[model samples]
Target: MTERIAREPGRSTFIQRTRRAQLIACAIDVLAEDGYVQASLSRIAKRAGVSRGVILYHFSGRDDLLDAVVSEVYRIATEELRPTIETQSTALRAVRTFIVGSAEFYRAYPAHMAALREIVAHSRSADGTIRHSEHSRANERELSALGVLFERGKEAGEFRAFSTPIMARTIRSTLDGLLGQMRVDPGYDPVPEAHEVADIFERAMMRQSE
Candidate 1:
């Protein structure tokens, strides 16, 4: 099985990278429209207008392709939010921007998020364990980032003393719940929901005046 060279030494050529990206996008489309079980290599290849062999040349198999899909989604989201969040004048502002930025990403890439949900919910490993378990590296990194923001705010006297882990988990859960709502009702508007959630967290975390 040839692993993608994007994450390894001697990185793949432009054409190789482009082909892998194409297959990953098609996999996301298939997972979003047809769910996890139906998103076979052949189905994804058909969506990409390529033969199954073309997909095989890029990814080892369905599992590898799904893993790439998940990683690609995270890469896209970080690209969308990191610069904006970094530009915030304060950690408190960064937190707010993170919430709003996430909403913007969800609105722009509903298919990617939906496909991620399907993969997280249904994808399994050789041992039949869930692929994207709760303690997955991606989830850990997200929580760590939020914890950093909260700690910065506290140090700056902008936030109250609180359990950073609990607060971080709550914020992440609330944001994920909005996407779940969107899945249930496609007409649901998450931007407004994000604003409300951000307001709630700001109030809960902010240190009130004497």
Candidate 2:
């Protein structure tokens, strides 16, 4: 029965992991629909078809559950954004592609956006480790992609020499503002606006032809 005892723990661990995933998914749905303040463990458990005690067994409290949901949202967002960031034909194109792709991703996944907004709104008083981690990862990827484009343009003498970090931050901030406007105004179409932003960015950075 040593083998049986070992198997039992392995099976228990698998079951626990599956249950936790289910609870996290339910939490995402609840938070997406109701926001953080209204997301309760009881509601999550009910949505997950599990008992409230089961949720408590996996997560210490509602805050812990919310944290896990935020992490998952970031994970999914990164996945959605990574492909466009990695595959641009030029740095300028990459930046524009990233901006437009991100807007499209949010439009397709409004629930994820809602969940993200709730996390930001509610996490003001909590430790910011997870949010900071997510932001850092996104910034690193975006900056790296922009750096590739900046170096390419500089080598071609088609763009002005400047700090990639600063430029990346400026572009990112612009995209963030555009996204905020799109989110606030349902009638705003980000595609045309994204192209305009890209044109302005390219013109600002590129050297004038003699």
Candidate 3:
């Protein structure tokens, strides 16, 4: 008796990358309209003008695609925020600038804010085993840039001496909270609120009370 073995599908690395990018772009569109839980591979493929099979070939499942979307969103956000952290002459200024810049980014890309809200809402219920190796590496680089800003603030005696990790998370949480509020309130204008919040945060955190 002869038995037939199934043939493995073949796709080039370049093709895989291209398809993944297409899927990520489609995910952003879907997420923008329907949020994360509603974004499906079928819908994404339809929006991208690709077949569902093509999406499945590139991503193992929804979670993988969502992770990729989130990673790309972070990359874009980091790029937008980089100038605030990199070009600032002082740490206090960096912190204030970062907060204001982040708010502007969220205002410009409301979809990113929506995606982030979905991630935070779902992360608790999702499986922890799914590996996000690439996402983690990207996050590390973004954090490192923020860390340099924090260290500079400490050197200038503008901020209290503290663990960079803790400070980074604190700053991130503050910005997230502000963005979340803005997302929910239709009347909220990010630019004015961002400047107000930045002013308050800077005064609260700066070593010199003025």
Q: Name the best candidate (by TM-score).
A: 1
lDDT of each: 0.86, 0.71, 0.72
The residue pairs found clashing in candidate 3 are: none
Q: How many backbone clashes does candidate 3 have?
A: 0
Q: Which runs in model 3 stand beyond 4 Å of their true positions? A: 1-16, 126-144, 162-166
Error of 3 at 158 (Å): 2.9
Q: In model 1, state the lDDT of residue 197.
A: 90
| Candidate 1 colliding pairs | none
List the RMSD of every prediction in angstroms: 2.4, 5.2, 5.6
Query: Model 2 scores what on Cα lDDT?
Result: 0.71
Segments in model 1 whose C-alpha atoms lie over 4 Å from true places: 1-10, 123-128, 133-135
- Each candidate's TM vs. the true structure? 0.91, 0.72, 0.78
**TM-score of model 1 (CA atoms):** 0.91
Candidate 3 lDDT tens digits, 1-210: 011111111334555566667778878888778876677778888899989877766666777777777778887888788755778777788878888888888888887677756655665444675344555565567577778877887887888767888767676777778777876885676777778878876765667655
